[model samples]
Target: MRRLQSPRRTYDWGSREEIPDFLGQPVDGERVAEVWLGTHALAPSLVDGPDGPRSLLEVSGELPFMLKILAADRPLSLQVHPDAELARAGFDAEEASGTPLDAPHRVFKDPHPKPEMVLALTTFDTLVGFRPTAEILRVLGALPTSLTQKLAERLRAEPGFAGIVALVEQLVTDPPTPQEVGDVVAACADGVQRRTDVKRAYLTALEVNEHHAGDVGVVISLLLNRLTLQPGEAAYLATGIIHAHLKGMCLEVMVSSDNVLRAGLTSKHLDPQGLVRCVSGGMSRLARVEPEQFGESTDVFSPGLREFALSMTQVSPAEPAGTPLPDQGRRIIVCTGGEVELVNEHDERLPLRRGSAVYADAADGTIRAHGTGEVGQAYTPTAEDRATPLTDLV
Candidate 1:
């Protein structure tokens, strides 16, 4: 097993304190948003070897997937990703146009679709997708006059996803007047005073407006799904699903891709056209991922994917598995609490602590982890397992 170095992605929406405090470090007073632990070219994680530091991408060469820990302080952008074909076409177009890969305005970064799973480490909140039409109507109807008038007309028409698509399209196509924007903000501000049930989303709308100014995400947030996940709870977003992480920290793992089509809640580049094309305009409900309990300390969360699988094991000093793990795929074991001794196939022990993660090669069969700590493992499948469809696995 080799210790791996994870990369941190700092964006403007990041809180300067939350993540640092979580790791038991002095809040660096600097905005620390996301920590990337996979093999996305932008900032692929590094693993230490006797010679030097090697990127995870170079190490996991032909391997099919990547794993990560995503800790967010404030909120991420309202965005969606394209399916593989669209991703490939967009990437090729950007390259052909001579657009720098690192350019802020560049949209497609790679040709891979990103289907992600995020499990809350705290009470995490987000706007996932559209809520039911009646629920949305109730939330919008409760708003103060001018703002309600603007949204009420269209929402009352019950246009479903198409109506929502049109409303968002119109707002983005013909930018709202400065006075009109002020009216919406004022309405949200007034609604905040009323303290309605949708107060959380209303507050988010105001913050989003201030962040992106006139971006259409503020209005979109109103019509999307509002979700809150307790610790150990998880949510899954498939290809073309529109969503945004609102607040608090979480552990996130996904297919290896960094392409995001932004509508708002960010100072970064906004890909309105791409975002519009990517959104599904359907009601996406909360993802229910029940942990599969095995013995007392181990619980597995497999979202029925060929690319990867994750497991969360709660270790008590009294209960220790004396044997080796069943996984044969490339595995990354991360310890979130206490310390653990990982014994290799040859019986070599690797000591790991909180926040420490190690990469174990696929061929390293039946490894043993015996100690008192909370650990999670991520891995890809073998040929035989890969041949089996995900539906059957579930």
Candidate 2:
């Protein structure tokens, strides 16, 4: 069993305490954004060897999926990821154009569709997809701002998904002025004090304003569905789902690609055309995934995605059967909470604690668990996921 060493990433919007305390580390006020646990070329996790610490890419090659612990204190960008077809075309075009992979303007990191799922470890707030047309009009009608009235008029004239897409196009092409943005925020704040049925919508706008005061995304919030995932609840986004995560911590799992098309509320490179391209998929509903109980102690969270699924198990002194994890593909187990001993198919046992993890090759077969506390197992498509182009599979 190879004990994997994961990398912790820091970003400005990250929480100061969530990740540190989760790993039992003393809080130092460092903003820990994400803990990457995968074999992706960029920020690959490592494992120790007699020679030295080796990249997981060298040890296990590239896994189909990546797992991460995300802790956010502020709103992230309103963004979308390209589908498998778009990812390949976009990446190839960028590559042919002689754009460096590490360049700030580079978009696609890998030729894989980035369909992601976030399982909340804390109360998580997010703006996902588009709200219903009727709902959007009702919320906008309450606001007396010119921006809101114009948006409401357009939505009423067209209605439904077409109106939503048109509104997105208008916002991206002709972004709201700072004064117009401020007016919408002020209207939403005032509405929050008076409106009851539409209070949640007003609050969502205000919440985005609290983080990004003058960004055009504050008005864009009116277009999305505000969703809150309680602890242990999960949300999944297939390719082309537009979203922005606001506040709280989560366990994020996705294809081993870092491709993102951001439009606003971020300091990262902006790509309005890329965002609109991704959003043109025409999705109407928010995607929510429920965990399926597997065996006695394990819960499998797979939205039937071909790339990867996550299995979480808890074992204590009370029940001695431990966790029997399924093999979806290449297996990597991380002890997110408490202490546990992992027994691989070869009968090798590795003891893992709060922040420790292990990786197993396809030849290793199934890995079982023992001891106490919680463990998360990642299941990808054996060894084929990374080696093959996702375009062929999807």
Residue 50, model 1, lDDT: 87
Query: What stretches of model 1 exceed 4 Å from their correct place?
Result: 21-27, 206-215, 321-326, 381-394
Instruction: Go through the candidates in order and give each one's C-alpha lDDT.
Output: 0.72, 0.81
Superposed Cα deviation of residue 25, candidate 1 (Å) = 5.6
Give lDDT tens digits, candidate 1, residues 1-394: 7888887677776768766654556876778887766677777778999899998768877445566556665568888878777889999999999998899998888878877777777788877767666777777777765655667688677557777676666665565665666666777888888777473667777866766665566777877777788988777677787888877777777777878898776778887778878877366644656666545566666666777666777766575554345476587887777878888877777888877888888556677777777777777644443332222100
Which segments of model 2 are wrong by more than 4 Å? 197-199, 281-283, 381-394
Q: After superposition, how far is residue 288 of candidate 2 from its true place, in Å?
A: 1.7
Estimate the TM-score for candidate 1. 0.89
Q: Which candidate is the best by TM-score?
A: 2
